[model samples]
Target: MSNSAYRWMVAVPAFVVVAAFGVYLGTTHGAPTALDRSVMDTVTGLRTPTLTSVIKDVTVIFSPVAVTIWTALLAAVLVWRDRSLVRALPVVATVAAAGIVGEAIKLAVSRPRPPAIDQLGAVEATYSYPSGHVMGTTALVAAAVSVCAASVGARVAAGCLAAATVVVCAATRLYLGAHWVTDVLAAICVGVGVALVVPVVLAAVIGRLAPHLPAWVGVPAANAGSKA
Candidate 1:
């Protein structure tokens, strides 16, 4: 299928799920659902000093500051590898968009974090719905997968690795009682959505405008000349 068609297929369902989940969380901000309580209970129950230490160590890697630093490095490497801003732009844009979208939704929803008594790890300062950690990491993983995977088999392998990373990221929040189940799940949806959709849209815009823009901006000189 065409890139446009594939993007549309992915974007529609992703945003829909994010919107629906956000609305649900917004409307029911008071208490955890049965499922939420059950999951939180199970996860928190498994918490121990060693386990918590390991999880916290892992979780810290996806913290906002860490994500920012690593994402910048990734973008730099991509630009260096491709020798073009065009390739790295999508990864940077997608990750940035994911962060902005995640924060916006959290403020709009204003969902509360899991109860303090339930928190077994580091308490968070932000609202809980649509976990930033999950969203950010998921976006990073998705961006990496999109750029690095070259073949169908490679894509599948990269996709599986990405999925595992996202799940682990989400689990950290749950294990810490920083967010409810819906928060991470919604984040995964939104993260993937933003990661996939932003690139496709950006690519199309860049494609159409590249020829007219300066070579340093996004269009390579030879590529621009070829188009001309």
Candidate 2:
């Protein structure tokens, strides 16, 4: 299917389905379900000092600030190498969409973090229905992977790294007792939707807007960042 069709047919449906799941969680008193609690306990129970140290580093590595810094570096490199920012638009758009949508849902849900009984890691003391850490990292990986290059092999490598980052980051959050299993899951789902939808939407906007420009803007995309 074409990108636009894929977004409408697949991405939009994914977003709706995940959104419904979020609503379900929100209505459930924000309590960890039995399964969620079980998973949280298992992950935290296995933590060691070495593991704790590793988890702490992952915490920072995937933090929103770190993700933004890395994203900027990636965009800078692309613009410098290509002498165009078109390749970086999807990366920027996805990150922006993720932050805005994640925050909106978080505040609307206002679900509290995992209870004190299960808490072991440093306190976040923030809403946790959909993990900000998970969402941010997910968007970062999705955007980075999507924009890293135009070659299939390069994109595949990027996908592998993105997947690994998401897994490790998600596990770190759960292992640290910073989030319920459901919180991370929901964030992943939501992030996937945003990653898929944002670039297509942004591309369409840019495509339409490009024609009316005064020729002072950046050149038309080589691939139009077409991978998105």
Give me the displacement of residue 46 in model 1, in angstroms: 0.9
15-82, model 1: which lDDT tens digit per residue? 88888877876677636778888898888779889988898789888887888887899879877776
CA lDDT, every prediction? 0.79, 0.77
Q: Candidate 1: TM-score?
A: 0.90
At residue 68, candidate 2 shows an lDDT of 86
lDDT of 2 by residue, 186-216 (tens): 8887787788777777766777888786443
In candidate 2, position 196 carries an lDDT of 77
The residue-level lDDT of candidate 1 at 42 comes to 88
Model 2 clashing residue pairs (backbone): none
Q: Model 1 segments beyond 4 Å from truth?
A: 216-228
Q: What's the true lDDT of residue 91 in model 1?
A: 73
Tell me how far the alpha carbon of residue 181 in candidate 2 is from the true structure, in angstroms, after superposition: 1.0
